[model samples]
Target: MNSLKRIMVGLDLSEMDETLIRYTAFLCSISEIERVYFIHAEKSLDIPDEVLESMPNGMPADEKLRASLIEKVESYFGPDSRVQVDVQVVEGSPLKELLHWSKVKQIDLILAGRKFHMRGSGVLAQKLLRTGRVSVLFVPENIEPRLNHIVVSVDFSEYSLMALDRILDSALTRPEVRITCMHAYEVPTGYITLGISYEDFDERMKGFARNKFAQVLERFPELNDRATLHLVKQENEDDIGELVMVEAKRLKADMLVIGAKGKSAAALFVLGSVTEKILRYNDDVPMIVYKKENEEIGFLDALLGND
Candidate 1:
């Protein structure tokens, strides 16, 4: 009876496919996720008209290839599985197809693998992170499963509040899951008076931020028993992305969660830079970018097509 009824996992048909399936199965087992969708995207072949005319009206090799991939996915994740599973193969862009499928089917979560190399820009991943309605779980390869340390970055924004609530409501709230709520603040340059004696503005700001954290904690009583707070000071004038990276390393956190935003007024149409930078640069740790909306721009929209 878990609320996350449908879970979608994007498959690349790579060596890590099995691991992705195993992780998805593990999640479904824990959350009682009712449906699991396995999606793979393929490009349509450019065969000459003469070649098509010569072929008989029978199953093509591409179809067989798609079938084999689906079978492999189902065999690994669907065997003796209580959760209902469906395999889908679609033509066109991978990210776009995945988002379209998610929206059309109303998926509750999207599970995707994180690449270590800069094979291609993660436009689809970024889009899904920013505007997708469901929660996203980005799993890094070779990460040993452990819930020992969980880091949730808070900006005191409504989006961060929603992300924190979702984490607590999900598997993260378990007694064994060690949770750290982090907030990083940067000191303004003018705060230091040149003529007068050094003011205690930094101390006052820290106290104010602590009070804000306290207010958020009061709104969620469930976290009181399972969560611990950590306040960070960013004296280097780095952005939120840098702050999160520093905090993740300092805490040796197993998972990082952040809220996504749009970039510019017009380009600000999708997920913001913080989430994208983490996904691109930080491959050592797995990150989850939670979204408030159901609609998301696909990978192809951002990378393949020009604006």
Candidate 2:
């Protein structure tokens, strides 16, 4: 993603819709986003008796929904606006429409509401983030948006590198903001077979991860303090996600950024277990999940039938 100019937001007509729109407006201003599409999908645009009595006869449901969304967006946007806004109401599954429209519209980023103790657990937004081609930013229902400091979960993979690059190159990396490159490493259980002590191997792992981070710094010489390294040891297979979140909370990070890294669609998970666990456990601090730029597209992505 070269820039966050064109973006999209998915609305489900719930209380989350307002939050999503408001967050999107805030993002557009900070990022200098040129165009934004606010879309809502419905399985069926059929009107019931209550809606029918409120509207004129023969008024289409999609148009009515579009008008409602326009009003909501206008309330948030200023009159002297440089951003172009379009409200669309489409039929069929929300997930498919989000993915399809993201590709068709060439969206750079996606913004959606991340509900905590709200009506839903924000699973649909997570699934959409996992399945789409574009990057997704999940905003909570009740948090002030800020990008002063970002914690990026780096595994030294190309995807993580891409994410860090995009974040630094984008508007989020202001002079006042800080970026943390955190890597969690685990010592192999089979190290005993090599006559290596646990403490020694753990030290070696830390050194190795630090060396990799140093290589990254060498490669990007311009990133003086724009990026810094933080190493964490994984105590268990399933705790890396929690460790990342807790560390982010510890660092008082405004956002947690991670890139999806995996192979073909047939693989068990292209998003990886750590990313999945993070999505499930994260209840605070907005996260932006970046999809692999050059992924092997396959049949499994257009999945679950709904959003």
**Total backbone collisions for each predicted model:** 6, 0
Question: Each candidate's TM vs. the true structure?
Answer: 0.81, 0.89
List runs of model 2 lying over 4 Å from the truth.
52-58, 268-272, 300-307
* lDDT of every model, 2 decimals: 0.69, 0.80
Q: Highest TM-score among the candidates is held by which one?
A: 2
Candidate 1 residue-wise lDDT, 127-210, digit = tens = 566544567888776566656678988888888887787776666446777888888876667665544322466776678888
Decoy 1 TM-score against native: 0.81
RMSD, one per candidate, in order = 5.1, 3.2
Report the lDDT tens digits of candidate 2 across residue range 81-125: 789998899998887888878877888888888887778556778
| Backbone clashes, candidate 2 | 0
